[model samples]
Target: MLDASSNRINGSIPLKMGEQGNLNYLNLSNNVMSGIIPNDITLLPNLRLLDLSSNSFHGAVPVTKYSFSPLEIIDLSRNYLNGGIPVEICFIVTLTTLDLSNNSIGGQIPYCLDNLIKLTSLNLAYNNLNGQIPLSLVSLLEMNLLNNSLVAQVPDKYRYCFPAKAFVGNKKLCGNIKGLRHCDLPFFSIIMPLVPMSICIGASLFLYSKRFDQIEGPGIQLLCAFLPR
Candidate 1:
């Protein structure tokens, strides 16, 4: 297997490497690379391993039909990549290990993750992703989703595997997770108190005005009768 991980390589990956279809394992992780990843790397036919994690790559990851197939391990974590994970990446049937933690990517986790029956380890921690944790990952041996803006109830199975600390620092997230706080229902504060108080004030003012009019009405009449008219 081609293991170039932790090599401290810098600069963008050259597009010329795409022609090497025979290469099965590619690892450039723990490097200083920056700029957009060259899309041409997807052309490798026999590529089974890809590691470009722990770098400075930015922008969307290029996805083609070949991006997912024949790949058992892929890591893009600890980088500056943004944008949602492409839908094609989740449907890759052969993907066994995937790490995409520590990024700025947002949007809900794609529903296609259920199709990845072979996925054993998945890491999507430290991002801006929101929405519920998909139940498909219940069978995963290991899954990390820490530090996201997720806002739905997590499945009991997943909560059992991953504690609340795995999902901390997300103020908007909720559920029975250990470290998370409960999300208050919308309008619970204002609608419950302010509305009732306003109605009570209005009713009290109406009744007082009616009583005052009744009391004043007879007095004025009596005074008018007593006056020389």
Candidate 2:
């Protein structure tokens, strides 16, 4: 348990800092530190809360291949981190609050992130994410996905859960929320109404042809009657 918030700690985190075998909570927020975030993970097995926000840390977020670190609340917001959000974050099922907002992160949100059944608060706003929101985020109690390049209809789970501002700045987003763009009807649905009319027209043509066929035999009989018989 180390609390070093609101200080002038400007250097990058040391690689030897993992020597603290029992360190659980690390708070290094509001500092002048600037560098690529350390990827020497899997050494801190007990780290649960990691807060490195309000710093100049730049580069991709570290993702371990195999992890036993019980991280739950991760606040790496307000940084200069880039790269796609890793699906490996979903592997940490114990996570609850994940705030990666206000970063330069790009790519689609991992669809498998819905697997995080314990997640409650998520903030990925002001990023470069683009794609449809997952259909279900059952455990989320709060989420903010504003100002991204995301497209498609807003899922029902998120349509009313967050306000329109949470979906603003996105170019192609549509939802039921007031002032949000409405979703366009599917092409199949739009053409479905004309199906019955087509069937009726086909049936009418067939009956007319059948009636003509039936009346044709009598024309020759009338021609024979008019001649000497």
All models, RMSD in angstroms: 14.4, 14.1
lDDT of 1 at 124: 91
Candidate 2: tens digits of C-alpha lDDT, residues 72-177: 8889999999998988887888889999999999998888888888889989999999877776653578888888998877776675577667778787887676
Q: Candidate 2 lDDT (Cα, whole model)?
A: 0.76
Please list the C-alpha lDDT of all candidates, in the order they appear.
0.73, 0.76
Q: Pairing residues by index, what is the TM-score of model 2?
A: 0.80
Model 1: per-residue Cα lDDT at residue 104: 86
TM-score of each: 0.75, 0.80
Which candidate leads in TM-score? 2
lDDT of 2 at 75: 93
Task: Give candidate 2's error at residue 229 in angstroms.
Answer: 50
